[model samples]
Target chain A: MIDMLTNILQTTVLYSTPLILAAMGGLFSERSGVVNIGLEGLMTMGAFIAAITSLSTGNPWIGLIAAMIAGVILALPHAVAAITFKADQVVIGVAINFLALGLSVYLVKFMYDAGQTPTVQKKLEAVAIPGLSKIPILGPSIFQASPFTYIAIVVVILSYIILYKTTFGMRLRAVGEHPHAAETAGISVIAMRYTAVLISGALAAIGGACLSISIGSEFNQGTVAGQGFIALAALIFGKWNPFGALGAATFFGFAVALSLMGQLIGLSKYVPSEVLSMLPYVLTIIALASFVGRAVAPSALGKPFEKGSR
Target chain B: MSQLNKQSTIVTALISIFLAMIIGSIAMQVAGYNPFAAYQALFVGSLFQAFDLGETIRTTTPLILTGLAVAIAFRTGLFNIGVEGQMIVAQLASLLVGIKLNLPPVLHMIVAVLVGGIAGAIWGFIPGFLKAVRGVNEVIICIMMNFIALYLSNVLVRNWLSEQGTDSTPKIPESASLRVDFLSEMFDSSRVHLGIIIALIMAFVMYILLWKTKRGYELRAVGYNPSAAEYAGINVKRNIILSMVISGFFAGLAGAGELLGTQGYMAIQSAFTGIGFDGIAVALLGANTPIGVILAALLFGVLTYGSQNMEHVAQVPPELIRVVVAAIIFFVAANISGILLGAVKKKRRAKES
Candidate 1:
């Protein structure tokens, strides 16, 4: 029983890392007023590139960096088309998703001549803290894990601080809430939005790296598996706050963890796997549908902030 | 001076699409394939052979409905991202109606499509109601609904709807099947059905609804400015909900087109069901107009159908078509300001001169 409890916690922690990172990413973009529906494609693209790069180079860290760069590269056209041109953000986002799906497959086919790239070696497997290794259950459970796990928690704290305490974040919040007010106050709304969205891209890349180099270590087309949408849901349920996002992300993580747990305790046979998979989505719908009051997105979420428009 | 809008939005979109296809063909030529031959083969593989032409029309039928589905909602300012979900739910509903009862042909057909639309409309408005009343973001809600719909379809297929012959629902009854292969046999190679005709009729209806009618004007007015519409006596909340219901109707029709026109039955895990997601692109590429959506769908059908031959003959992955799609979208999206800037510059230069 203790082991099962520990296992579920462990699984939750593992699953939450990527969701946490991606939700933080989503927080950055949506908070900046750019609705980034392309995050799904972005994360999937990063995971594919990271896995292939790590396998090709045999360096997981290098793969991680490459994935970030790859994510930025993919984000460029989307940003240009969306931010600069004043094209519909949602339309461009949808296009980017399809583009990524097609382009990644094309690249994979070109380089490896196969449907998918090889699995990565030198994975960022879980590691125990040396001093804490000797302690009992809680110590082992709490103290030992992948470096990314710790980074995820640290990032949550850091994201909260950056979004709330920093002048840069203040400018972003101002831009999102009211562009005219921010502009009058000398905030470059477009620049602020750019910064937020780029950071969104970078943070999402880390989530992709976690999936590729730590959690799964293989390049599959469906690896991201709609976690980007989960992150988006988290952002909304969190009301665009970093702390609320953390809670929502953890809920999804726990739901996913339960599915894995069901496999271990002989519950998998009774419950349909598809039904289990639907739990997170069902929970999200129920949360979203209740509609107690307006969960106002950033006033500028999908409206492209053009220079001279205001 | 207004040539851009003069040609109509759909024509402008088609021009971009043409440019993109040309670029793709050039890419093929650069990669050492015979561009002319490949181009010819692309057309022939999709339209020249009877089965090929059937495939093209079949693919186009769903696109027409899904494209209009997206176009209608976008015009109403609600991004119905759950069209895929709506379509899936409707697919299951249509299948149940298609396979379960022992009704006559015409009754079953109407029941299947109508039930499908009702299922979709019911599923689509959850987010719409939330958005209208609670101020929730409809896009995120719709997207979440999509995931749920997919899983729900899987569950339905596994537990209840599994056909006696296979792990899916029983094939549509002989009364319900829309196989047009009988016509194809006349040509010695075809599978086209009457679904394309239905899709065209729906597109026409949508055109009238969007441009000529009172409710359509209300929907459009709400899309342009909801607060203003409210001030002018348009019930913004009602329009929003109505927009979603209308959107679901078209999406459901897309599912109907698929089942009645081609697949002869419905199953959850059959395909990725990209028609809904792809409909967004189609709508954008088509400029969210009915005629434009039809052309865009047909063009996509050609590209997808032709690319299969391109893959087999030229060793180029059919995924190359995606590059064209992405590039066109990029150009359409990324170059908007550039083109506007150019037009502005041209006007300025004329003034200076």
Candidate 2:
């Protein structure tokens, strides 16, 4: 029982790492009043770039950086369309997803002469903290994890600080809440939105890199499948708060961990594996409907800000 | 919301398509392929040969329905991303009905189709109900529901529907099948069936329903401006649910047509069929009209079926078609024609100054 508990906890944290990172990314963009439904695409680009770069350079760190850069590059069209062109953000997001999948898959086949990238030469390694490694059940699970887990935790804390404590954060929130009012106060709403969206792209891509480099060692069509949407769910369940999103991501991770490990732990005797596989998605719907209550979005969410119009 | 005139809408669509084609050519050049030859292969492969044309029509049939599914939702101010999931559930339902039911020939097919559509409506109703009553965002819920439907369908297929040692259900009964002998022979034994005729009929039905009916007027009003719709005494919640149900019904029918008309079995799928996702592109390109959806569906059908020929004949990857489609959607969403018009007007004013 103890061994199973430790295994579940460790795996849960592993699964949660990417979700936490992506949820934090989503929080920033949504807080800045741009509904970024393109996180999935951003993560796909990140995963593809991370694997390709890591394969070529034999350096996982460089791959991670490349992934972040790729995410920002991919997000440029979304930013231009949503902010400058004032296009429908949802439609732009859908287009982003299609473009990301198409471009990545096409390039992958072009470069590798295959549908998927080969495993990277170097992968991010798990690190075990010396002192914390001795703790009974918690030590191995919490102390030993991929570096992305630590990064995700740090991002959550940093997000909390940036969203609630800093002056820039205040202005960003103000812009999202009331762009006209923010403009009246001399804040550059467009700049804030652009910055937030770009940051979202970078962070979400890192989350994608976590999947390709940290957990898995390669990129494929399904490498970042649906995880980005799960992250979005986490952000919503977290009620757009930094720490709340982290907790929500962890819960989703736990659900996924349980589903994945249920067979290994001999729980599949009672439930079908397919049913187990559905746990996270079903839990999300239930959480959204009953537990999370009503999530109030940013006032300017999904709205194009006109300079002089209501 | 300012409605563009019909002429401008068509112009915008043409410009967007042209721009996307140019982008596709640039991408082909970057990838070391000849764009003209690749396009030629694609067009010829999908349209010129009888068998390929039949296959294109077969591929286009379900797309038309899914496109209509999405277009109706868009017209009613909803983004029905769950069409994919709804279709899956509907396929399962239709498969079961097609396999187990003992109804007579025509009745069995009708029953299977209706059951499939009803199943889809139920899937759609969840998100619609929540959005209508609880003020929830339908998009997120629809996405979540899609995953649930996918898993549920997989479980049902493997556990109950499939024959022993098989990953899919048994072939559906001939009574429930949509294949017609005459149509098959006309297309050189292609799988094209009655689904095309049904799809075209639905498109016209949808057009009449939206333009000539009072309920559709109310639905459109609610979509146009909910507050105004409420003030005008339209039941916004009911319309929301009704629109979703109607959209889901067609989504299910798309699945039924694919199964009963072509595949005739339910296989455990590892991933989405992508028809639903493509429906979004179709609706956008079609300008959310029935006639436009049919045209857009044909375009997508050509691209999808023709891409294989591009790969076989010109060594161009089939995935390039998706990039081309995405670029088209991007241009459409950005209203590239409007921007060009603005630029031209600015140049004229500069000359005057």
Candidate 3:
């Protein structure tokens, strides 16, 4: 029973890492009043870039950087369209999803003559912290884990600090709450939005890289499938707070972990594995509906900041 | 003002398409393929061959319904990303009805279609109701619902409808099928069916319903400005829910048409069939109008069908078309033509001075 519990807990942490990173990325963007529905696409590009670069360089760390750069490249267009051109963020975000998937797959097929990239030689394997690795169940699950897992936790703390303690974060929140007021207070709403979205892209891309290099050994079309949206759900369920998002992401990851291990745990005797797959999505709806009491979005969320207009 | 806006939209769509083509050509050049040859193959494969033309229409049939499904939702200020989920649920429901029910030919088909539509409406209702009552974001709910629908369909098929070892359900009887002899013979035995007629009719019905009826006016009014519509005594909540139901009805019909007409059974889907996502592009390119949707679906259908030929003949990846489609949508969403028009006006003014 203890072994099984440790296994489940380990799997939960493994699954939650990407969600935690991506949800934090979403927190930055949505908190700054931009609705970034294109995280899926950004992540897809990130996974593809990370896999390709890692394959070429035989270095997962370099691949991670390349993935971030690729994410910024993809996000530049979204930032331009949403912040500068004042396009409908949701619509453009959907388009970006399609573009990212299509472009990545197209490039993969073009270069590799296959639907997915070749698995890289280098992978971000788990490492054991000296003291904590000697502990009981918690050590293997939490302390002995991938560097990306540690990075994800660090990002959560950094995000909380960046969003609450800093002047930049205050200005960003002000812009999201009321762009006109932020403008009156001398904050450039456009610039703030651009920075937030770019940060979102970079972090979301890192989340994707974690999937490709750390959790999974390679990248394919399905590598980043639906995880980005789950991250989005985590962000909402967490009510746009970094710590809240971390808890929600870990909870979602636990659900996913349980579903994946249902048969081993004897849960599949009652529910079909396929039916088990619906748990996270169904829980998300229930969470969105009842769990979060009046989770309010930013005031200027999804609205273009028109200068000198009410 | 509306007339000029309509004209400008068409011009915008054309420019976007042109730019997308240029981008596609550049991509092709990078991939070391002949753009002209790929283009030639794409056009010729979809249009010149009679059988391919029939297949194009077969593809267009579902697209029409899904496009209309999305267009109507967009018209009502809701982004029905769940159309894919709605369609699949309807597909399963219609297939089950076709297999399980014992009825006369015409009645069976009608019952199956309606059953499918109602199933979709129910699926749509979950998110719509949540959005109306709890103020939940429909996009996230819709996305979640899609995965659920996918898993549910797979589970249902595996448990009840599967043929021993396969993941697919058994094919339904001929009485429930949409296959007809004359249309197939005309198109060199392609799987064209009465679904095309139904799709086209639905497009017209939607157009009239949106432009002609008081209910549609109310829906549009709420979409345009909810507070204003509420002040004007419209039931905003009902409209929101109704529009989603109607949108779901169209999506359900698309699924039914595909099952009863093109394919007669359901296979366990590992991923989405992408018809619903493509519908978004179709609606956007069509400007959310019925006529525009039809035209856009045709264009998309042509690209989809022709891209396979481009793959076979020019040795290019079929995913290139998706890139082109995405570029087109991005340009449209950004209103790229407005900037172009602004530049043109500035140039003309400079010349006059």
Regions of model 1 farther than 4 Å from truth? A133-142, A291-293, A307-310, B1-7, B22-41, B163-167, B186-189, B266-271, B334-352
TM-score of each: 0.93, 0.98, 0.98
Q: Encode model 2's per-residue lDDT on B1-353: one tens digit a residue.
A: 13334346777788888999999999999989999999999999999978899999999998999999988888888889888998999998999899888999989998998898899899989989988988777888888888888889898898888899999899998899999889988999999988899899889989988899999899889878889999999999999999999999999989889989989998888878889888888888888889889999999999999999999999888889988998988888877777887799899999999
Better of 2 and 3 by DockQ: 3
Task: Fill in the DockQ of model 2.
Answer: 0.73
Sort order, DockQ high to low? 3, 2, 1
Clashes per candidate, residues 3 or more apart or on different chains: 3, 0, 0
Mind giving the per-residue lDDT tens digits that candidate 1 earns over B163-235? 7667666678767655555665754655566667778998999899989999999999998888999999999
Residue by residue across A100-178, what tens digits does model 2's lDDT show? 8888999999999998999776799989999997898888888888999989988988999998999999999998899
> What lDDT does model 3 reach?
0.89
lDDT of 1 by residue, A56-173 (tens): 7888878888888887877777777777777778777877777777777766776677877777778877778888855665555557877778888898999999889999888888
Chain A TM-score compared with the true chain A, each model in order: 0.93, 0.97, 0.97
Weakest ten-residue segment in model 3 chain A by summed lDDT: A291-300
Clashing pairs in 3: none
Which pairs clash in model 1?
B50-B189, B50-B190, B163-B168
In candidate 1, position A246 carries an lDDT of 91
Of models 2 and 3, which has the larger lDDT?
A: 3
Model 2 chain B: weakest 10-residue lDDT segment is B1-10
